[model samples]
Target: MLPEEGVNAVRVVVGMLVRGEYEELETLTEARRLTAAEIAAAVRRHGRDLISPPDEAFRELGGVAVPREQADERAFHVDFPLWTAQDGLSDLTLGLTVAEVMDGVWTVELDGVHAP
Candidate 1:
């Protein structure tokens, strides 16, 4: 099993993507900011409105994502495979890696999202 905190952070990030809440991603990132170019690139690569579940769906979508691999909580890198959308749960997985700013606190890094 993955750490709860890490899993939840991924959930929030994925929810923002699904809802097309691009601006909110900056807050969840390690640098605490994302330039327009970066966000634009992500949109171009991931596509806008890839998933559009209602706000409440965040709570119900994807059970905790188990990391295919992870470091100890105190380690800086925590990478895992996570489903990007509800419909793709059975097959699709996006590679996600976070940097632990502090113990047990994982923040998404730039280039953190990708195909596994």
Candidate 2:
């Protein structure tokens, strides 16, 4: 099972992914402010299952390392499989700040990419 925090993080990630608003850094940053508890509650309210444990649901979700110019911060990169989306690849790349992963949200810019 995914930790509550991880579950929460995935919730916002999935929501943004579904909305197609995840391509902008500013939008993602705003979405990242949502709390894990908030995400969990939203998931329950929305009746959606977006993430599972590392060995389970997320096994297909690939993770990559993100390097930050600042020495005090560490970032992570993630890519959701093509199956996660209704159409097209909703691959996601996330950058987390010092704030707990459950609380912080980072944004990426998707330029010149059009959704079908």
Candidate 3:
């Protein structure tokens, strides 16, 4: 579920978030993109670990499709709801900016992780 594979990229990124896999998370960030890095940094700063959250936390992996203008067909947004029950860190939706690089192929990148 690599971020390069946009289909299940959200789930992979969420897993990385819970497991504190900084390097792996960094790899998923879009090249030269600072937003993703900042989000990762904020999550790390909190030092919250759920250990093993319930399966329900990941039930919303596909995310909500966001409408885009005709000229912006190459890229679009999807907000994936990520549930959590841990103290301090509650549930949040991961905002993903997906880009259709070439034809059917797409790349998923973290736009932001925030409370919904």
**Local distance difference test scores for all models:** 0.49, 0.38, 0.57
- Report the number of the highest-TM-score candidate: 3
Looking at model 3, residue 72 earns an lDDT score of 45
For model 2, residues 1-116, the per-residue Cα lDDT tens digits are 32344435545554454454433433555545544344334334433333322334444443344566756543444333322223233332232332233234433322221223
Every model's TM-score: 0.51, 0.37, 0.57
Q: Is candidate 2 or candidate 3 better by lDDT?
A: 3
> Clashing pairs in model 1?
none
- Shift of residue 58 alpha carbon in model 2, Å: 3.6
Q: Which residue runs does candidate 1 get wrong by more than 4 Å?
A: 30-36, 46-48, 52-94, 112-116
**Model 1 per-residue lDDT tens digits across residues 1-116:** 44557557766766675565665665556344464356546555654235543544334333333343344433223333333444443232333455454676666754444543
Ordered from best to worst TM-score, the candidate numbers read 3, 1, 2
Quote the positional error of residue 91 for candidate 1 in Å.
8.0
lDDT of 3 by residue, 58-84 (tens): 454344445556554455566655545
